[model samples]
Target: MAKRDLRALMQPAAAGMFMKQFLRWALVCCAGVFLAYTLSALKVNKAPSDPWAAHCLSQFLSDARSFSTATSDLKTTVNDLSAGDTASLTHARQALLRCRLSYKKIEYFMEYFFAYPVNLYNRAPVHEIEEPYMEYQSPVGLQLIEDLLYGEDPFAQKQALQEQAAVVQSTAADIPASVYGFEATGVQVAESLSQELIRVMALGIAGYDAPVCKSGLPESAVALQSVKAVLAAKTAGEQNLYADSCMHYLDKAIVLLQASTGFDTFDRLSLLTDALLPAQEYLNRYCCQQYPGIGGEGAYNYNARHLFRPDALRQAAFDRLAQSDTAAGLVALGKLLFSDNRLSGDNTRSCATCHKPSLYFSDGLKGSPTIGNGGSTRRNAPSLLYSSYQYGQFLDARDASLEKQIYTVLQNPDEMHSRLDDVVRKLDNKTYRPLLRKAFSQAGKQITPAMIARAIAAYERSLSPFNSAFDRYINGDHNAMNVSQRRGFNLFMGKALCGTCHFAPLFNGTLPPLFNRTELEVLGTPDGGSLDKPVPDTDSGRFGIFPIEFYQYAFKTPTVRNAGETAPYMHNGSFTTLEDLIEFYNRGGGAGIGLEVPTQTLSPRKLNLSQAEIADLKSFMLALKDSL
Candidate 1:
């Protein structure tokens, strides 16, 4: 009876087990169906037919058509204008204004790809610098024509105006073909838009472009319209909410520009704070969310909260110099070698002899004295605070690499006067061997001159500091700069021409977008700042090494970062005070003092800065005192 009961219980248990298996299979099938549905939904919602690039191309073509037509009309108007003036000059001005509007439609796009040509066609005539290879140029573009055509002597400038119109027409004709072949990514477009917007806000609204014409207000409206079109094209279809947000801010900016009146009377601060800044902020937000890898460049970055950040630039510079080694070890070994006197011929002096860290890495002397005995060096010992960021080393830019610069200085009779072989032999001795082992490990086992040079280079690369009050102001701390400093900043970027050479952020010669190469200038520095009896300094400069006519009297543009601390300015230490140095630049260097420099790269025209303006500029330079 007991066995039969047990068998009966087993039968019910088997049936329960089958039921459980059936429920498990049914639940799995339902989950698979739900997953498929979710994936299908995502595919439908995320996909858009006309992507950002497609919309951009379509808008570009339309803008090209408008530009071509406008140029043709302007050309006809110019041809009709004569001395008697068959058509009123006012009508011609209207036509010119229309043409500018059409061009503004694709301004940033063209400027980004064909910057060289665009600059040639549209650059202001102020403080134009000549290069070694290029021919001398006068102001020959739209701004020059604007000045002449809208001046008191429009009738007198009829022929010149007509010629300028023809040049502009040809340039406009080339835009379509140039734009069609060019390739660009969405991030690059954003960068160009942001930069051009800055130019538009800072220069355009200030009547810099339409100085004599007083068409800044209208021209700004048209420029804003072009920006609007670009934003519209990029954010064409659904599934781009971030771009839509960008479009909203851009639309508001256009409205602000359209409503603004009086070129000289318009509130520039309002436009900057309200319209431009908001649009820029939104665009930056979109870019960071969409493409985190792509970055905004030197003058501005939508990704960056402020206009300037030196830490990022310094890191970028360091990345280029040291590719393999740990920065910590390399810097440590470099610091040790920097102070060690064993590298010298008599083992009595080292790099620290001239470059003292306490004095902003400068020797505080007019010229670098000899290491062994006391003798004078021809050139001043430039502070090495940020020397590693420069491409060419030394006052003449003779050494292409920092390592080579060390070697050159070491062997120079007036400097360290040590042989590389001798230095390497000394470094391999008991005192330095252990430190080398800690820095380079296996590579340090057999010491060489190159290794020592690299260690020193690494330390030099770590020296540039960008945390200054001016930097803070540009980086979004409005309170950092006082009113005078702000005015000085404007003058620096505008009439002063200091920014034309010592570029912002780095405040050096490293060009933007690709901050790899450096530029040299022939400033025609005088032997003394005495206006009563000025004489041109006779230094062969870069020509000594290159032996080229153009390179004569050319020296590297040094960083103006620590101008407050590093004194006895210029290659020869001619100016003893900052005020005197400013005066020298204000008078347009040696050429302005009646010295003949045939290949003088610096413009030989006085800046004519007022006393207040001079004080303001000085204030700005002082603000660059490194916080670090």
Candidate 2:
């Protein structure tokens, strides 16, 4: 009887259970219909404003990796070809050149991904420029960024990266090299490895503040961090502004790499090697782009995104200690002293008074502060535009180092009329030293004049005289210069015979970096200073520094880096206009001004410059301000 009763109850329950299953299936089906409808609605609504925006971006990233890999493979192949002692290397070099052209176009697409369409009237605003930069990312950098941006697992992605690296390592063995390009040439692989490590670490340490990405459910977290960073930039420090996204990516990349396969010397060095330019270009473009409402480099109104990477603590510490720590405070103090008029006895001038920042830090005066003209200096004030890159110091090359040069100018009776002792006394009592002391804590009590000059010089040195239209032309910019600038540049190197003195790359007195001092020559300048009657200085030029006749009249070559700005022209500021200067050069040096030096190569060299040629020369000089 008990069993029969249980069966009766079970029969009713079984019927109820079957009905419940049918209802549950129906509900799930309904949810699927709702989800499909919602997604279709969103697609219709949003896709118009962003037509192919998502596709464009995804396609772009995909192409980026493909292009980078393709170029790498091409480069390796070309290099491998060059290794063979071919009957003619022309084919290999030609192929290499062709491949480079393609690679560069890819670089262009990467660099100006968001380049606004060019308008004929779209004159580049004050200094807004979208220049080309190489486009490539290290395997680690690429993988880490992917994981952060696309919700991929970092460790798994890193494992895939290690396998790719192993392939690259094997491929590298089969490749050959030229001294001019490629990251790791065969002979100095060891040194290359060391450099790569430092580079990777700089990149790695910088990644700490990026948005977090994981394979799990916190989809809103990255958006949240980026949003907060954008907001906080209003009151946050510059370091924070630059570091927030870009740095975070690097940190995560570094962490993932370490966990996947521990870094050896090669991995560390290689990352940095491949990364330096990309890191700088990305940060520079991102950090400096205008934010409309904000005044500083990193304005609060704009937003940009980058993926995250975690940097291990050890890596971070290593980079921080190894990197140069010339702080912003130092740059600020240097700018202050450089422009301070109070440093002079007459209180009439400052370094900036002579070196106008807008005019490429050159007054564009033939010479500055004309004592006789009741104007300032007579000769053109050569633009210090790239003066930091100048080897040897000063117009006459009287000083060897920046240390001594600052002292000379300060003590010179005509220029500034204040001694180093006086400068120290004036600044000693001022309230700037404490901040400096806090900065250079190690040099607490020892910070002195040399340090001050170096700091200023360092700021000056940072003024890299690159990015000129001429440089762009040389660096393969087909449309960089207009026909006039292009023609003028050609004339300068050839018929103008300017390269006889000013060389390429640095385009200064020497082919060397400013760090390695080299002296150069100009014919002579008119003896038209305070001495009404001429007393011959015998072109004693840098001979003031090295008491040698051969060195006489041999002044350090003023970097054409920014000669476009500094003017009056020459050591004594004889020429008034760039036109006059060009004419004088065409006629050949000081001869037109009654001072003649037969040995002056520039002297009366048949520049054969017509009125048009003269105009072209000036046009070329003006074009040089691209460094601005």
Candidate 3:
């Protein structure tokens, strides 16, 4: 009996000890797991030093030396050339090409560090006739000399050519000197390389830069060589596999250019898609792998499979703006404010009057009727649909932000003709006050102009629903487009050169990867569709705001996403039908239509598209209509 009692007592004591031991072990395991997680996170956050930046810097200096030498040779060639002599002129042309080749090799460096000076030396004199905003300036660059040399009377402009050559030499010499003053970073090199490739594909291949000479092919070859040089620099002090991948493609591009019979025969689209873009993608991947978070906030990764995407619009917005308010509440508030005529001075009209949802958010008029019987607006009322995807607002690109653009429309005498204070007072009613409170629920508790603008802008943004048939086709539904539409797509990207300006997907000039920058073109539109005796549109466009010669008559390129639906096209709403609008572009704007638009940015050559081809093109445009 005594032995049994002792055993029971021992069992209880042992059980208590075992429970304490198990708890102690669990605590130890948890502490070990926490320590490991902390260490792993620290390792992941650490970034490595980039070796490509230093390498690219050294290579740029070498390129600068070559460029300087070429420019000096060009100057000598120009000086030695005799007036009215064929051989001398031929030699001069060759010399000019040699200089251009050297320039093309280092075009990235010039475009990056010395954009202003480089413009002075190499800017194309396509339609540079007059600029009332600046001093009466004449076109003075390589293109200026090209016109003189290729003209019927080359000798007559000998002195002028010599002067221009001197300017070019001075510009080239300054570039090398400037290179030493600046420092290079890995992110900058990656960004510059991507931009350079895009320039090559867009401007260079389209013969925009070297129009007179048609030297795009050979110049592009030299540019590819420069790209190789850049890649070689990047490969230094790093793994060869990634850099070599890009180099292989670049080598293929150079070979393809070499094999090309002529400019007309060369497939620019193939080169862009197969070679250049892939190279850019690999380079981007390598950079990201080597140095995380190097390009700074909102900077493009450059590794996107496609050139453009609709979501890029939101990504480009500031983090604060993107996360500011609930989309549903803001959109609801915006919709109410847009239709409320009380926002105007006389309660006669609202945003809905001009931008009716029935007409794809356009007024469907040549020019929108004046807000208070003031006649009509000077320009066409551009469709609000998909406008939120653009980098800038207004034909003149006066407002860089959509929210800021609201003020101009509200206050314009011929539009809303209302002050912000008046609008705010009207909106400070029971209907709007609570809606505004719900929409904001934070900082915009009180109805101010900014809150009104933000709410309206939010509704405008909601207009871009991206449910077009083309979107479906690109997103894997091959049956979305007909054969004619497919052919038109090829022609648009290839022969028509529409993609050069109105970029793919969004079909606007907001450049891709990060669609933050807007581009303007000087199309030289006629006054009133008078092709027989076409008169230049009186509007000074971008020049009126910036007062710069380069910006003379420059208007922001609008999106052609719903061009089929939005009638009365162009900034002025001159064309009445799609055929008329297509014909204008086919004839290459005013210049091709027999107008002496010296500063016309559009290619002044006829597209020579047959009726059938035009029909196909129209079909493609029609396919861009949104599901809404």
- Per-model clash counts, in order, read 0, 44, 2
Ranking by TM-score: 3, 1, 2
> lDDT (0-100) at residue 12 of candidate 3?
47
TM-score, every prediction: 0.74, 0.45, 0.77
Predicted candidate 3 versus true structure: per-residue lDDT over 263-306, tens digit per residue: 54466545755786677667666666766664455534344543
lDDT of 1: 0.67
Worst 10 residues of 1 by lDDT: 1-10
Candidate 1: misplaced stretches above 4 Å? Answer: 1-50, 64-105, 119-167, 179-184, 194-228, 236-282, 295-307, 314-319, 323-325, 371-373, 476-478
Per-residue CA lDDT of model 1 for 176-294, tens digit only, reads 44443335677776666766665575456545455456566677677777776776666655556666665676677777768765543354444555556666666667777767855
CA lDDT, every prediction? Answer: 0.67, 0.41, 0.69
Q: Which prediction has the highest lDDT against the true structure?
A: 3
Cα miss at 86, model 1 (Å)? 17
